[model samples]
Target chain A: MTSGITRRVRVLLWAARAGAADHSAVFTWKTWLFGWFVRMLAQVLFFATAGNLLGPGQARYLLVGNAVLMVALHGLFATASTTWELENGTLPLLVASPSSPSLVLTGRSLFWLPDGVACGLGAFLLLGPVVHLPIGLSAVALVTCLLVLVGLTTYALGLFLGSLVLTATDLRNVVSNAALVVMMALSGVEVPASAVGPVLGRIGAALPLTHGLLAIRRVLDGRGGGQVALLAAQEALVGACWLAAAVAVLTLRARRSRRDGAALFLT
Target chain B: MSLLAAAGRFQGQLVLTHRDYLIDLVRTPLLAAVFLLLVRHSGQPQLIAYGLVAPVLMAVWSMAMLISGEVVDSDRQLGTLELVIAAPVDFARLVVSRVWVTTTISLLTVVEVFAVSVLGFGITPEVDHPVVLVLGLLATAAATAGAAGLMAALFVATRTARTFQNTLSYPFLLLGGVFVPLDRLPAWTHPLGRLIYLSWSADLLRAALAPAPVAGAAWRICVILGLGLLAALVGRLVLGRVVRMVRETGTVGLR
Candidate 1:
């Protein structure tokens, strides 16, 4: 009998394979270049506008905020793309494979790490024209850690939403879209949460974006990675909650589908 | 030759289409409510702050149209394209009618936003220039219709247009002066904003309603309307040719 570690590795390998398959259709180098070109152009344009509008230091802060925001968007929305697959009747096949659903989703999201990191660096590079911030390896480490937490939480949310497709009638896409748009608006990425009112401020304070942004803000202001501990803890707690929720919902949906003989909808 | 008969036919179609659009728009009040709450939360809870909601709401409207376009695409894929094309009506007229219906629905959605602002946020439109306001709204409606049509055509052509639509639509949301002032855009994006119908429409509305009178608000409205009409024409031409080709060739098994 294989040990648990070996078995887990096998599952991870299979999950990676599944993730690779999802993008096989659109994974051309041209597509990657197109995506990068568009994103980089937009980022440059955004930075130029911000630099002209704000003081140099403030522009640097805004860029840091946008960097953290890019991580949040790439991580969270990448997971949601998996939910779209599930809702479209392609997720069941992946889940039925040797790989677990969570592993599969993780692998799929991790595939975007290269793109996210590249674009983030591109955005950070533009920051030099705006301000002279003390960005070092420690700031990088903090952003990376915060990104991990964001990815984990977002993956869990995606799984929970995907599981609902088993019995949902029509509102899945609407719910997903609404959730994403609301998250983007409330994340305090573009605008300060404090400017938005008490209710929105409270909501923003509870979000991972707020914590990650605060961490980056401090780092850009000369504080090192030490400030990330509080944010990491909150993100860990939120990730745990969402992960547990995803497991419960996925199991319930899978069990129901099996009982109803509707497992065909999974793939 | 009777005017009543012609008017009856067109009016009947218009009313029915408007009713369908209304039903769809009203089905999701929660999102609209969230937008209202977002504006209130943005710490700019004055009646003039209603302008802040324009960008996001317009984006939402675009998404709604995209979703509906996907539905239409699915129908086309299922061999229903020919049925619509074969109907005893001009293709351009049909497309325009559908867009008109959708634009009316978006207008109603804005009305709902205003109502929510008045009730929930305690804001009121100054209504200094009623003519400008009405014209501005109509211009905005026209612009939205054009954008929707363009997206519909794009989606109809490519199966994977959703992601492109999603990523590309935000420019209008951000650069169109809906949430922020247009002057805030960097020099580069400022000119591009002119290319976007939303920017022109938003500028017209803002000029009409904001405390100060904007120079050439009427001209901006005309330019926006012209762009909108041009977009609508292009959309019709592209979608019609594609649909006709699909019908003749049965390409990709679509009717």
Candidate 2:
């Protein structure tokens, strides 16, 4: 007798709790900060300094670009995490239930969102000045908002990919890692969209991280918040489309599997 | 040695058909793309050698040693560590054989990255000294296999082994001049590069690509061999100590 949206929200909230409980053992705060966070920062450093090898000016461009890439990584987390229900032998139960599985899937990896945002922001704040990136008060606030939007959009893309390959759960992580690697190459992360040429530029335009990275860079450029807002809105829109596609795929896959009453995705 | 060779060949055959393993190799080209494309965009085509060569060498480290380190971690997770520890075969030798398979397999990345550069980027990176290049590849494979011992020891030794392994991956790649050269890194980090065999191997391999005569190739190759031997010795000692402790504590069952 609860409203439909309300019930789904509750499922998401509870699923996020499960996810938090599950991953808490993987990395305590100390380990997460000193260990995982440091690793992400080092990755940013690796790319940024590599940029410096080309020319001094190229460093900050790469620093900002790779920093935002840390956000997209959370999206990849969503891919593997959504496949968890399939992993833990709960796919059949969740499919059998009247509740929507996509909601639960979304919530399961919600923990990665904050971690992604932290890595993105930490890369910016900690290493920004090393390359002489001007960090004013307004810049920080804008970049934070941009990071959140980018995280949500990329997470949506991840869910869609996860749903598409629910049965082949073993390849979920591979898909996520490969997709990220491809994105890092093709996305306007290290190179401008225009520079990748027309075909690749169009492909980059369609990816979640491309627009999000642009928004972050625009925010840093301080040309004004208007363009950044427009870019953020585009990122959010892309995310929404991915979210809708994810829901449709999840629903169709679940119903079809239930009808077949075979291949329960135990593996 | 024959047993090791046979074991390595068997694992290589199995991993060759493995979806996960093949996909791991597939990353080499994409990684190459990421590095080379950045150089292209930077308006410095001469620097392309670093981009072209780095991923191939990085594939050596990540594919051979990084994946090699995971052997123990995965065995532990699969509850096979106890069997491995108790097997009649020597544990270190078993691990060395597994690393042997991956090191040989890692060579395919050389072809993969080179093809990607020529076909994908239209840049042909030439090797001026094939003899030194071939010798460098052999020495690198040996050194990489040797380091796997250390990597495995770390995995068996600590609870934070995975994190440690993850942390070491890119830094090693960085030290190896994946996207940046060794000289470009901070002067203070120079000695640290000396500690990693990939650093010397990168210099040797890149020098082979240059048309100029490669000086001190023998010394560099010897240094790589020495470092590799040292790592293997240290790895065996640490692995023995850790296995003893794990057996004494009976905590192989625990993380």
Candidate 3:
């Protein structure tokens, strides 16, 4: 049992490293930096311009919201990389392996944590001069924690969605695109939750990014540390629940696939 | 069938059979709805109009761009690019036909957004000059197709064509003034924006939708059409050169 656990851990670590390398291999360091910087800047400018038209004192709101959203977006893309396995016809092997499929999925997403944090921090820092928000080091640190939680939650949610690709492989683009737009609309990414109507506001409350954004806003506005900590705790709890849900869903799906021999015929 | 007719029919068939292509049709309106949701709280009729129109323009541009942007690469991926190239047909005309069909399909997004804006949100944008608005949409479609052809020519031989295609979207949206007026951008970018046909198209669109007519409508329309012609000429030259290069190097389906 001890060796089995060790072997699983070793496999998980190997998969995480391989995933990270594959993700990074899509672009050179220079290309990645330039592409992401330009993309994030464009996104920030687009929303900030819209905020300008909306009303006064709203640019900052949009800047922070979109910056944090970059993290969740990264998480979504990271989890969606699982589709590559299906495309390459390796998904069934992963499912049929002695190691747990849930663990493998989690490992596949581990690298996104750092990638999300970097995007969040990079967006904040890059847009800081443009938007001119009053962010200090301590506040930055606090937002970093908030972004980490958001990343975990979004990654878990992405994993759940990615696992659904096992049955509907062609849904990869539709699901990711729809989820990004839906999350952006509902999670106060570019709009305040209160203004998004009661129904959407309730939905937003269930999303992990909403609480994290709320907490980051408070910290940026110089709120007390106690409230920030409470919000962070809530965000973490939401993320934990999503991770647990993803595990349950993946387990159930794996069992179904095995029982029906669907794993053998996955295209 | 003629190459143009065949290409158009092929593209239409692809759109019909490919679930992904059908899903692509829905992305724009969903994004438009998201934009609408973001600005719904503003309660300002003008802001609502701007939000609604921006997404429609983006949908038009994206669809036109993707038709050419993905055409060659997709053919290559499916191992049919060499066959298409080997056919004794005007390749540039084939590309143009494909883009034209895509542009026509993309126009549905404008109607979809209009319906959503009016029926879903109770915001009916005013079009003071319906004729000018229609003309503007036509010009925008032609210019976007030209630009897509130009990009398709440039991307056909490149390994990172898809990446470049995706990266061009936001920058074009910014420079095209899809979401904001040209004057709102940095002063230096104004000239750059004016160079893009989408900027002119957006100006014409905003003017048509505004309660009063804005000046320079005629000139903007002329410039947009002229740019479309220029892009078409340049794209034809580039596509011819790239095809020759690919034939010489025998890299039609490579990568």
lDDT tens string, model 3, B1-255? Answer: 577688889988876666556555677777777778767776666666577678888888776666656776667777888988898887888888987888788888888888877777777777788888888888888888888788777677555655656567778788889878777888999989888888888878878888786687777788999998898888889889888888999977663
Q: Enumerate clash totals for all models, in the order shown.
A: 3, 0, 0
TM-score of the second chain in candidate 3: 0.92
Q: Which consecutive 10 residues in model 2 chain B have the weakest lDDT in total?
A: B14-23
The C-alpha TM-scores of every prediction are 0.78, 0.94, 0.94
| DockQ category of candidate 1 | incorrect
Per-residue lDDT, model 1, residue A59, is 56
Give the poorly placed runs of model 1, Cα more than 4 Å off: A35-63, A78-80, A84-121, A126-138, A165-170, A184-187, A190-206, A259-267, B1-53, B64-72, B154-163, B188-190, B243-255
Model 3, span A148-243: residue lDDT tens = 888878887787778777556666666777787777888888777777789978987877687888888888898948888888888788778877
lDDT of 2 at B248: 92
Q: For candidate 1, list the clashing residue pairs, or say none.
A: A92-A266, A92-A267, A93-A267
DockQ of each: 0.18, 0.62, 0.60
Docking quality of model 2: it rates as medium
The window of 10 residues in a row where model 3 chain A has the poorest summed lDDT is A165-174
Model 3 stretches astray by more than 4 angstroms: A1-8, A264-267, B22-24
